[model samples]
Target: MAEENKSCAFRTSIGGQALIEGILMRGPEQQAIVVRDQEGNLVEKVEALKFIRDRYPILGVPLIRGTVNFLDSMVNGVKALMYSADFYPDEEAAQPSKFEQWLDRKLSSKKLEGAIVTLSVILGVGLSVLLFMVLPTFITGGLLHFFPGFPMWGRNLVEGVLKILIFLLYLIFCSKQKDIYRVFQYHGAEHKTIFCYEAGLPLTVENVRIQPRHHPRCGTSFLFVVIFVSILLSSVVFGIWPITNVWLRTAAHLLLLPLVVGITYEFNRWVGRHVQDNKLAKVLTAPGLWMQNFTTNEPDDGMIEVAIRSLELVLPSEKGKDEW
Candidate 1:
């Protein structure tokens, strides 16, 4: 088994999300969540993954898949987060609202859980838009009113910069929170374990411990790439048409977001496949890797164990099937 593991050299498509006290790993065929419960016991749940592309083949096409995958990831991520939080509930959390109470009384437990997960995903996406999309455009619009002579291209540049700044600030603020710090540690563990696997090493805590906590394929990196691509694309679009109206510019941005995400996803995929030894790839991924310093921290051995367990449960049965 060890020798077989050592023979693989390619990166896997398998990826993970760090949870409150757990790690969630998704492979081609299965998804697993492994959490360390309040009593220090490892708890794991695994389910066969049913890809949307399987049912709707059109959705699997390259550019289209990126948007679909993004939304699917959001839903899965929110659900995983909710599951992890259940194992470590806050004693001081507010009591359920009357509407929440009514829902609880009317629905079965499983249905209620599903509703909560759906709402959480929607809210998460809404928050992301308000922060990274709507906020920066509005801020730039306000600035344009103050300086009516601001260049159209310059407006795009300012909005892009503002988006990146807001993103960085958000990550920095979250990293400082007590609970989020622990989650970041688990994030580090997830990356390290994935690195160890790609290196064809035995998935022991010690092996994972010494690996780098940054990975080229991280969603954080994808997000940075999205921001970068958006800036470039928006500048080009606005430069060609030269729109001065802020609301119109904002509307244009919303329309262009799917294209931005698709292009960024393709770029990230290229970087991930070449990053091992390609200097150009390394340079391309540098910003995201640097950002990992704020979003990921070294995990303790116990956390490493959770990450490894989560990963092991989702490993492809056929060698190289998960190749990137």
Candidate 2:
């Protein structure tokens, strides 16, 4: 763990996701997914990279890139998960439901798959927004209803605290799930392997095993920053707008989400660039890193092997091409 804190040889723009008994790594030139089958054999798949920004340069701009990249990541992550899940079907392999059958009949196989992934992304983002943003607003509005004179500042404070509380509870619930526990272990392996790579250590299980599982640029940290930034941004916007209606306030939050996400993305980029040398940047990311305790666990050697191989497959051939 101590070695994980040392200044890295260099950071990489590469990132990864932990899937069902597997790891998905995305690099500059390609992406790789490696899953461990029930038979204990590793299955690997690789795909060439395609960037939406290549055709739509404006989407690559700092603020715009955040929302675009966020959606892109969600879509890709969901697809990777679905791929891994195929290797571990339910014991009974129940037949498709009526709705599924209807959809299969109505849409081509490709279209059906695409529709499912798109719907998954929408539901995932919608749930997050409702849980972290809308719920807090309504809860705060109700709590302060009796106190008509309650200051907006106080109201915002209550909402902010509630948001954090709800988020923590959600993470706690996920960590307690039996199936999710193993995924979290793979999450840890992904981080530790990345740490090893940044430190210029050999990508061996022994080396990754000793590294820290929490990472400053983790998706968990990115989500935390989004919440933190939204709290501050919402407080300012609501203070000026002073929308007393709970529904209106919720609408205002949804409207401002893009801006909040943009700002958070830029802030993370700045911190990622400076975290190695700047004490302030490290301090800023401390909360997110601490939250990893609920989202990651010590992975076994086998998990580390999978993570290492997955990362290696996605690394660019040209030296330094993937450097952060």
lDDT of each: 0.88, 0.92
Clashes of each: 0, 0
TM-scores for the candidates: 0.94, 0.98
Q: Which stretches of candidate 1 lie over 4 Å from their true place?
A: 1-8
**Model 1 misses residue 257 by how many Å?**
1.2
The residue-by-residue lDDT of candidate 2 on 116-195, one tens digit each, is 89999999999999999999989989989999999889998999999999999999999999999999999999999999
Tens digit of lDDT per residue, candidate 1, span 1-324? Answer: 123323445889999999989999999899999999999999999999999899999998888888999989988998888888888877777577799889989999999988888888878777887888889999988887989888887888889999999999987888798878999999999999998888888999989898888888998899888888888998999999998787887798889889998898888888867877578998889999899888999999999999999999999899889999
Q: Best-fitting candidate, measured by lDDT?
A: 2
Model 1, CA-based lDDT: 0.88
Q: Model 1 reaches what TM-score against the true structure?
A: 0.94
Residue 280 of model 1, lDDT score: 98
